[model samples]
Target: MREEPVKTKNANRLRDERRNQKDTRNGGEQTVLTEMDGIKNAISDVLEQLLNAEFKKFVWHLWNGVGADIERIPRAALENADRQDVVDRMVQKYTTNAGTVAVQVLLNINQNDLAKQLEVKLQKASSQRKGSALLITNIRFDKSSQRSGAEIDEENMEWLLGALGYSVEKHTNLSGEEINTAVSNFSKRYEHQCSDSTFVVIMSHGQRIQNKDAILGVHYDPNEHPDDIFFVEDIFSHLNSVSCPALIDKPKVILIQACRGDVCAFRDPTNGSFFINYIVDMFSTSAHKYDIMELFRKIASRMQNDPRFSQSKKLLPCIERTTLVKKFYLFPGLMK
Candidate 1:
């Protein structure tokens, strides 16, 4: 992960400024705060500007459901409901890659108690703790590479991950066997073994397996001929419960930025592919306000608006498996 020395310095400076802003009359103590409060305060900027004035009300109504008045509910039950549990009850989405649900809905559900828990977690800043690592296999093929745009995408990813304090390991242009070795070895790394979560990113030229939807890598043997590419499922096979015990309860994020087929849609010689562009765009503005799936939805919405998209159908980004028990946040600290 690369950083601009100045951005880090500036962000830290701003953070310090806010901390010492002196909200109270007596300078005896700095302003008190919590993680959940911080998150809600940050997102309030977006919510305040919402065009649909009644969106929050509607989400709350939906949460209350067809019956069961809020008036009758006991305070004890409300006090006990956690944010993660509240999220599970409020939204019914694909078990795999159900992505982040609406922040508005989250704020509306048991708003007091859940926020308190999240606030505590946030202030602790556990996401940026040591031992956490991110693995990236950025394949810009040596000969038939993904173009200069891909390089920019790699830089962007590094910055984003770095900002979140991830010790990012990037492996570029690997063969099928090498890719397997890299991941197999990574799963065993001592750093990740002690970490709370992991992210695996693969970018390459890929093809769909015959009659199947699995993505295949651009692996070619020394004979100067194409060979068996990786089966995308192998990603999970290597990291799932029985296979990689270290990541059993931890969040394992897999993002594939490869071309799924031989087709090309709206790619720019300067800006790069649609996926990479929107990825940066979404993450650049996102401040832990939405989950990875919710972020993907934002990307999907933007892709739908592409000038050439309606004319030339765009490929959808695969959700793969989203067996996350709790929502994950990159929680980038300060970008360089």
Candidate 2:
């Protein structure tokens, strides 16, 4: 009798453990379902607010980005679908990423207000994240003339990086080799594991060597130390996937404020260089609402109209070596 009671107790414990495991599994699935429902509802709210013609345009734009992919919903499936049906299909096809896709499409249609609303709604569920940045400014050079008004540029950039929630690691007056070493060391920093994005802002006098962009170091001189220049391509290699796995799939924003041609940075006697001033102005005012790319576009547009960059002295800020795979918004003040 005693043996039989022991056996029965063992069997009961085993069955209870299995039941608990099953409940946990079901609970996870239920959480996913709840999240999907929330996305669908939020997306549907925007579609509901749209007029007939606008709704048609929205659908057309959505299909343009999503169609032709085997994993995406077929266009035929959405041809006659209502708002709720379209929402359901998007959620079903893209899962958690559906909200992001919807936001992109909304922005494409000039529905900025709706897109911002949707993004805010989705942001509540995102995990808290941090970022880091490297600001390397070579204001004074050995042979080349000093970067006039670069002090102001450095201050503005540092402030902007902080506002964007990045802990800035700044370096000044480093040689070509030292700059390379700084970047190499920064790439290996453990902070990257916890960071969602990073920035590498290098400001110096630059020249094109055999059609390759090269940023001159503080010790660079044409006659004395001609080789004291860091190639822009090296920066990419240091932070690329093969070298810095920690930053893989995360946004790596590299802003180079060096001239690609013979022209040097134009400085306002009081403020700073034209590039830095415009960047600080645009990002400070509109970063919370617009993504990085849009902010850059606004800056470019401003430059095009400004009296400073006349036909006589053309200074154009160019973006190069872009490897970003997704939209990056500063969302300033969120961390604060």
Candidate 3:
């Protein structure tokens, strides 16, 4: 007679048996489709894509539950909670199913794309390296030529570059030769091989010599024996396709926030220069939605409409040169 067929257990049989026993003790069946941490992270990430007002609306809808199975959380409990706090509360209330509930809230708020993003699990999309940026700012100069508020521009630019996923190589108060060397070295960096684009931002006192834009170095002085200045054209030469093969076919943005006058650039004592400030504002608000050219147009439009230009009509941030083959969007927070 054949022996009774012996039962075989899989590798996770012991663990599943223990889980079943624990569920039995709780008097309910609990199936964990996604881990608690993963649920919280996905919900938090998707919620952050919403604007401030949209975020507030999302929080309100989340609390109301509207037509969902989630429990009605109190307003006072979430009134002071931030985004992370809300994620925590959602996960705590719904356990491993918070991702689904959060997706529903996003849909209710008309953020359908974001809702879809949350519904579909995402894996790492790119293994390429993050982009790189070169920032050169000259604030102080000889003969008491302190750029009263240039530091603000440096700080703001650094933050903006960082937010766009570019590791910024910042140089402050460098001489002309030093600035050139910095750019040359930056162009050779291996990061550009994997990066999609790069930025070269130079801010300083500027003057037009022989119809060429040049930024005055920190040591430059009108009466000085030797002039210390870096021609803006040389920057293009260093990062051009011939010189920087790594950046070939990539969008290279060159921003020169300096005046063409013989004297120092216009700047606020506390706030930075108008050009840099406008750049920060426009990029911060619209970079995610619009391309670089569109953003430049918006900035120019703002400058043209400024009340300050009503009298002189002189200072305006214009795109000096652009060699972009296609549109470039920052798509902030999408990478990294």
User: Which candidate comes out best when scored by TM-score?
Assistant: 3
Q: List the residue pairs that clash in candidate 3.
A: none
lDDT of each: 0.51, 0.72, 0.70
TM-score between model 3 and native:
0.64
- Compared to the true structure, candidate 2 yields what TM-score? 0.61
Per-residue error (Å), model 2, residue 100:
30
lDDT of 1: 0.51
What are the runs in model 3 whose C-alpha is more than 4 Å off? 1-129, 262-265, 332-336
Q: What is the C-alpha local distance difference test score of candidate 3?
A: 0.70
TM-score against truth, every candidate: 0.56, 0.61, 0.64
Per-candidate clashes, comma-separated: 4, 0, 0
The weakest ten consecutive residues by lDDT in model 3 span: 1-10
lDDT of 3 at 135: 96
Cα lDDT of model 3 by residue, 258-334, tens digit = 77754334566566676777777666555656788888899888767866544544445657667665777765323
Query: Candidate 2: where are CA atoms >4 Å away?
Result: 1-129, 332-336
The model with the greater TM-score, 2 or 3, is 3
Q: Cα lDDT for residue 81, model 3?
A: 88
